[model samples]
Target: MPPSAREAANEQRRRLHHEADVVVVGAGIFGCAIAFALARQGRSVLLLERWLKEPDRIVGELLQPGGVAALKKLGLGDCLEGIDAIPVTGYSVIYYGQAVGIPYPLNAGADLGSTGGDTKGNGEKPSRPEGRCFHHGRFINQLRQACAREPNITIVETEVTKTITGTHNPQVLGVESTTRNPKTGLREKGYYFAHLTIICDGYASNFRKQYINRKSVVKSRFYALELIDCPMPTPNYGIVILGESAPVLLYQIGTHETRALIDVPENTPTASPAAGGVRAHLRNVVLPSLPKQVQPCVEAALADGKIPRSMPNSWLPPSTQTEPGVVVLGDAMNMRHPLTGGGMTVAFSDVVILSSLLSPERIPQLGDTAAVRRAMKEFHWRRKGLSSIINILAQALYSLFAANDSQLKALQRGCFAYFQKGGNCLDGPVGLLGGIIHQPMVLVYHFFAVALLAIWLVIKEV
Candidate 1:
């Protein structure tokens, strides 16, 4: 190619620029929800996605009851329909061979009704107090479709390279992107100018470091397996098994398919079918500990010789922000272990709070950095009410279940015993886990109570 022609092409690419009130990067759950909410309020939104097709992944499969309520408030209750999603009533936990059932609080139904109302206008709620779980890809597609239906939202299929910033101030002005044709392999560069840029890219977001200066630490990893024809002892309840090696979670994702997530230490040897690695680990360490009804499905899965999918479990402590005109959210902003299945719940809750703060009545002009910054300040604090509870509970619970020390194991026993008490004791923690409760102090109180119970039990044994 000649230099003159190359220069001409560069000039053409530089001339391409689009504008919107808000530019949202990544079309995952958070991005889609935020775009839908903003568009519904008559704001012009540009939602960008690298892949126009539905996403396939193992995470974000479960939506807590609280998330369901938030979805209804957003008028997205119907997204849960036509997906063959399964209802999750509560949890069935097996600790050291003893088992107990913890149901969602009785007030959950009323709570849903209070906030959700009859979104369908049929005088009935589309969701129940119970949660729902389905294929992650299908759920995300529903959210993307919802955004596509909004008149104010423009969906773009492209890759966002970086944020466009102001000349003097540190405020964000827009985003730069690149588009590629799948058939001809042609690439084009473009820019999107907006008053505010919202980043909802997933856990591995590239824009996160540009906005926040914190690093996510990997605590462990989860190996996922799909078990066909698996039936839980309690059909409606998800199961948490605390065995000797690590904790295992089992829940039905479809009518005939169940998903099992087995926690593996970061240092554990990788599973390989060639060396009989996964088979040996399951047969020797995991299989013997499972309940009788679940053994057959796990055994069949092992015999199939396909290695399970693995995902890193990471934690990022909340951080303060000083940047203006840019808001980083979802897993990109904060993440907790998937053991509690709260990722989607946290994301939805963040959208609910952020959308409310960014409503037209709150900020008349989208480009007003002063107003957006002020609302962001309130958003940062208000989000903690729910995010903190869920974050602490997930970390604390994973510690108890993945007990690596004798002290933690004792606490794990105490935790199970505490649940076996069968009243406020179980309901309190379960409510927090299900996203109904938002009190951090309530979580601290329950945590210490379990510790005291563990100490008491240990002393009695000695």
Candidate 2:
């Protein structure tokens, strides 16, 4: 190829991704999913990412059964394959010293954007829904690969500086981003235009505060460590250990590697460096709290002298999308504690709802700002049935599991005991946690039931 022709080709590539029918910011979980969904709906997309490399993170490792189902619905289920992902069937909760197994409800189908979920039965899906766990980076890479294969989608590596809006109204026109020049191999400023822009820039989003006007509240920070060939008390389940110093989540990400995330709330004295730091917290508080068989592995991993990295566990409720021609999705818009691993489930579910509401059949043209805003309003309300339920339940359970107050402790005991009661008491709560059941009333009913039971237990002890 001649130099002039080569330069011309490079310039053409830049122009190609500079404009599209829809511009998606931040190719994280929601960004990747939505870009693919909209592309499949016959819309050209520019999926922009600040860094176009595989991401290594803690929060997105576990995909609840509901999320997996939604992924399948988007025709991206194959992303779960060949990543050495492990299947998550249920959760084993260990409280102080006692333990209980809360497997997912049998015969429950994935919500799949259906109203209130299929509480009865969907003969098409498996009777028992199964979740999947893997390295967060691997899973995301797979999703990105799938997006690359799509003809309508062009993935661009760029850092979005800010959004560009019309002077007349606050409606966003597109974005001003820093796109690297393919010819010079140096960063250069460029602009991307599209009819609609969706932001899914993970928990720490740059455009969120300016657009959504909601702040993410940090509940706690989860410090993570990787254990090799660690033997757990159970297989095919996410192990939740409460009363063992905050809340600990253990799930296998691969055949031999298990990811252990230990939650350390802010200003914790035990985790303070002066008080021997997080290692002391793990040695004194977390070590003894684990099952005896798993003790050696935690100790060995700690002995490696690897100081764990931490990610904030935050709660950001859904705010209405009033900004015309621009919408915020994923963690940028809302967040919840990772206690039940509901973030991905809620994200995928949101995509299902958003995809349905914004389908070409309904909106027809991506350029219609009015139709887009109306759909977003509908999305804000339509998604509440699942998003609110998951968000509320994740926070509430984190409160109960990590309860410090005496009353909360009592409720925590009752929550565990409620699971022990078996039947709907166990199935209902677990189903909601795994994102299998969509009924909000089920969460309310069980919460009240646990409170009442806690009262009885307290009185009986007194």
| Candidate 1, 1-462: lDDT as tens digits | 675564344334323446777889999989999999988886778898989887878889889888888888888889999998999978889886788998877755656664322245667544436789899999989998898787667788999999988999888998988999778899788788788899888899898888889999896788788889887877878889988878899999988889998887765553444545755776777888888888999888777676678899999877656577788888898999988998888888888998999999999887898888888889889989889998988888888798879998889888888998988897788888998888888898998999999999999999
lDDT of each: 0.83, 0.85
Q: Residue-wise lDDT of candidate 2 within 127-209, one digit each (tens)? A: 46789999999998999999988777788888999999889987788899887788998988878888899988888888888
Root-mean-square deviation of every model:
6.6, 4.6
Candidate 1 regions off by >4 Å? 1-17, 114-128, 269-279
- Which candidate achieves the best TM-score against the true structure? 2
Positional deviation of residue 438's Cα in model 2 after best superposition, in angstroms: 0.8
Against the true structure, candidate 1 reaches a TM-score of 0.91
Count of backbone clashes, every candidate in sequence? 0, 1
Instruction: Give the total clashing residue pairs for model 2.
Output: 1
